[model samples]
Target: MNDAAMPKGPATALEHFDVLIVGAGISGIGGAYHLKQQCPGKSFVVLETLESFGGTWLTHTYPGIRSDSDLYTFGYRFKPWVGPPIATADEILKYMGEVIEENDLSPHIRYRHRITNATWSSRDNLWTVEAERLDTGQAVAFTCNFLWMCQGYYRHSEGYTPEWPGMADFKGRIVHPQTWPDDLDLKDKKVVVIGSGATAATLVPAIADDCGHVTLLQRSPTYFIPGRNANELADILRELKIDEAWIHEIVRRKILHDQDLFTRRSFEEPEAVKQELLAGVSAFVGPEITEKHFTPSYRPWRQRIAFVPDGDIFQCVNRGKASVVTDEIERFTEQGILLKSGQELEADIVITATGFNLNVLGDISFAVDGKPLNFADTVTYRGMMFTGVPNLVWVFGYFRASWTLRADLVADFVCRLLTHMDEKGARKVTVELRPEDKDMPLSAWIDPENFNPGYLMRGMHLLPKRGDKPEWQHSQDYWREKEELPLIDLDDSAFVYAGTKARTPEPVG
Candidate 1:
């Protein structure tokens, strides 16, 4: 009970930090800069609900976004993207504002605040939180001893708007490549775009040169793949001087061991070499749009194939300036879009690129002494702590390689579990994974039907399994997570720690 005895409306209280970090994104500023570089006199903050700080590159602003991995494996292995190879979102928000002003981390960041709730007191082990502040809507509170979330999912930071049916009587201008409006101007008009994944193959070759006819639509079928990503091998490893943090940890462990050996040989031999990589993507989308819609019924790495670079959405749908339409929208009219075989289509602008809106981690709420937290009855402990949740930690990444290489191996396993709880004084730690550690059968590419969230398939049954090296495995490979989480050793016994009392300082007002 601090933050000056929490009360008054949009609350405000403080003090008691040894880490709080909810979502200053990029996995809570890379787990608060590796827990302030391994507990450098610990006391952290980071809240951030956006007052600006590139979480999803400053909340994604549609139109040709970019970075489908490859800025030296989507940056951050102690910061290393000297630029280019798919970046732009204002150059990854100016490289996250130069990694928060070269780690001065904007005075431990607070921004627009917005946490919403957190609990776990257990006779003052700490973790009170609360937050609100979407600009003076007030409400705040704090008390830490480690929490960390790193909010990833999505909860309408504006995007994912589906429903469709007559969509407020169409009349054009629908958009939603995560809220892409930016003064809506589709030159010759006609647009459309619906969804085939990866934001409808990167918004149909980036709004087909200012649209005049686009279409896309698709309700199923997605395995596009063509992405080239060339910053000319990071400018020939910065003119062979290399060491941009060892070439972003060896090109993010060689693109996470070549996307886990091409998704484990395209799912353990999909009739020999994933049917020749789906017949070389149906001879590069030819045979009448690969039998009318790049053939798919779920197979090639189940779902996740929307790279498109050199093939640029199959050369903007074979030069007709885009037009895919596999069909299924079924409703929405005021000026077009009504397919399910009825075929209406028209549109002057529609876009959906229908996806996102999962909200497992970002919906944040948690509780413990006050009970709450039914994060579907907790389970994930190694996929970043949970089992009974004690000094919390969330992070979450890898929908199959390159989400900042499993968020830089969960920020080097949370700075090697906060330097093995500061050399055993141990104030708190959790680390789980041992219900007989799920008796084998884990990596069907981090299964749980490849994430539709059941708290991310019960947090991939507390991760770290895919062995055969890669240092006791969870290795989405990246050079075995740079030799098992940044050159190993931080003590282990698979984490657990406890002890308390030593985290007091608060008052920041």
Candidate 2:
């Protein structure tokens, strides 16, 4: 916590700032950097619920918790990532810490400040944010001219784990990776991990040697890209004695360009892309094993493709340290899990690597002018701002590209919007549907046909709607957004700016 920026008023009094940023994670830190660099005059403070920074990386303590996406693109654009493409949780934390230290961001960040409610006052052109100190249990109030939400999309307190029948009867311990116990003893323990997502893949290889035997159980197979973690482009650039910053930018752009092509190929040539992905895994596990436990029914990119460095999971399987099982769970038995195929897998411990529960707006209660706000009732403006919401922007990143890509883009947009507001002397800015877009078809936040993750699907009803117009929807296209976002016209009809003209005071006499 930065004592200098700490609220010094009474508990009931409001500590004010020009902008209030939520969360101190990657997006929040990036937002802070952009704000300080671009809008140096604006006063701001960051409120984070966690004890420290590194949101997901700090929260997840499961064995082998690492990035599924390469760090070259995952890392911030302003910062240089010199490590391997695939980095562990500790490495990511170190990288994020460096960003904070290098940029002198610690002074503006207030950790353990959990925002509970936010209310917008249209008349006053401000937002009243209510939070409580996790350490002191004291309520705090804050007023900000604008709100920037970068709290991330999922609940970090607990992971999503489906209840199994007879789970209570099971004698072994059951744990969810999101809340992995620090004292968890896996030595010589026969462990069965549920779900075959990135978490399971990462965990199996990390603990395979310690466990007597580890099994990855999945209801259905999922796609993975298994390859060397090193980035050839970055290695070559380094060998050429290139500056680290230049190497970072060069490698990042190259990876993104290739990613764009791969994304296009996935949609255009689905089967070819699918075969290419499976072939990568087949190199280590053989075609038979790949077909049995690695082949997904859906086409490539239906869900996220976890990247496995050096095919570690398959290597563990070859060494007889780990095994993969593809079957639906019947129920939990006294010994372990009973499969629908009438197979009983005995295990001393069960780890659920299941996904997460989506969190909308940090699950913070929001109100506008004393009226409760239901996010689902509003429409999204490029998936950042809401139709009726004023002076607030949320950072919702891409599903395909690195999340930081969109975060950086949104930071740029917010800073630009803030600067525009200052120039126009406007205090409130809200996005509204234009007359031409009044009859545009409204749909789910995202098109399920395009991308549908389980967490998003479960929480779709709670999210805002999307309109047919590109401005009224989040395209989730980094390639297009990188160009279109900065070019967005703030003076367009979709934007409603107010509080510019000062009201004349009635007779003083």
Candidate 3:
């Protein structure tokens, strides 16, 4: 392979790389690092649509934007997170930036390159990716042996907001957190925020002091884990002056172990786990408020349980700066909203912190062997590679645990698969259902009963199907995946390797 032969920029010629990673977010950054460190022999490039790195952190500009999951696990396994357990978006971006600077990943990443189409050719064992440079509006192309999709599974252009009657009649501004405006002022204005998800929880407290009155209006209550942001294990390790890397590994393991136990108890001892979670919130807002606004009908862990970090949200509620209203919205009123209970609430600004719309595969049109790819028609292989999709892996993270946890696992899997392909003199590899799995029952990507969020429920039809087997389903259990992903049998019959193309020798300077 010669550097002189690579495509320089926007041109009719396609740049050649051993691997092309989509998105430069946390997953994408980690993927790039893994490819560089584990498979140094492979040439790779990361294409991000945004002007800079940090996919979600860069796109989301809403106040109080922070991670619900702890940074110990949310941060990359190779990186040492020195911040508090819960981190703000700025802190996260700084951390991700350090990863890039430390690893010299900036040169390998091309910003403003929005991939529009990815076509796989079986004969050539290559993927031709088409992209448009958002800055210049010029189209670019790249050819790669493998496509790594780290683009997240959500619509970044806008957040999902349910249409309410008479929204146009309202005299105030209505905004979704995903697309929060900078010039908008909330000072001395009565605000109403809709939805009970993490976004709502994060926003209410963030703007409570500035707003005249902020109310969290939810149709139903959701579970929350209100606690201190500090991790006791990390605190002790720091006191002992232990190495930062050692502390990170120790705290990460402790958190994952506790999370697994808590998740298992949510199903095994639903009543007990529910009471424990309620007690945590009750400690801050009291039993009445906890039962009325924090108690959820479903068991704990059904949906994500956000960590409140020093009970910040509850503190605002306790001090009378913010309030919670549990009722369905009948329609929008001239001033605010009309509830089903015949109550009218007044508001000057409405923030719909309602979830995001799922965008599968970065909303890129994909094709295999010249046929359009209908993801719903295919079944996921361990929630990464799909049936009949060759030389590609989609990094879909976990639901219960931190997302980067699985990202690291998938990185290792991809690196291993690439190395194995090189050793076998193969250029393409696709996962197919084994003969024994041909008749297995198939269902939605994720079971509603296990973990059903509004966004997932609304976009389940757009996702791929999943089989009953462990290898076929995502099995969002990070604790198990951390142990299993490393030991996966790459030689299993489920993996079909093809094409006898040998690796090209590197060119001398």
Query: For candidate 1, lDDT tens digit of each residue in 62-176?
Result: 8778777666666677787777666768887788778888878889988887777788876667788887776666677888887877878666566556575778888878877
The number of clashing residue pairs in each candidate reads: 10, 0, 0
Q: Give the runs in model 2 whose Cα sits over 4 Å from its true position.
A: 1-12, 501-509
The best-first sequence of candidates by lDDT reads: 3, 2, 1
Return the lDDT, model 1, position 312.
82
lDDT of 2 by residue, 224-244 (tens): 999999999899999999999
Q: What lDDT, from 0 to 1, does candidate 1 have?
A: 0.69
Query: CA lDDT of each candidate?
Result: 0.69, 0.92, 0.92
Shift of residue 282 alpha carbon in model 3, Å: 1.0
Clashing residue pairs found in predicted model 3: none
Residue 202, model 1: lDDT of 80
Cα error, candidate 1, residue 175 (Å): 3.7
Structural RMSD, model 3: 4.2
Identify the superior model by TM-score, candidate 1 or candidate 3.
3
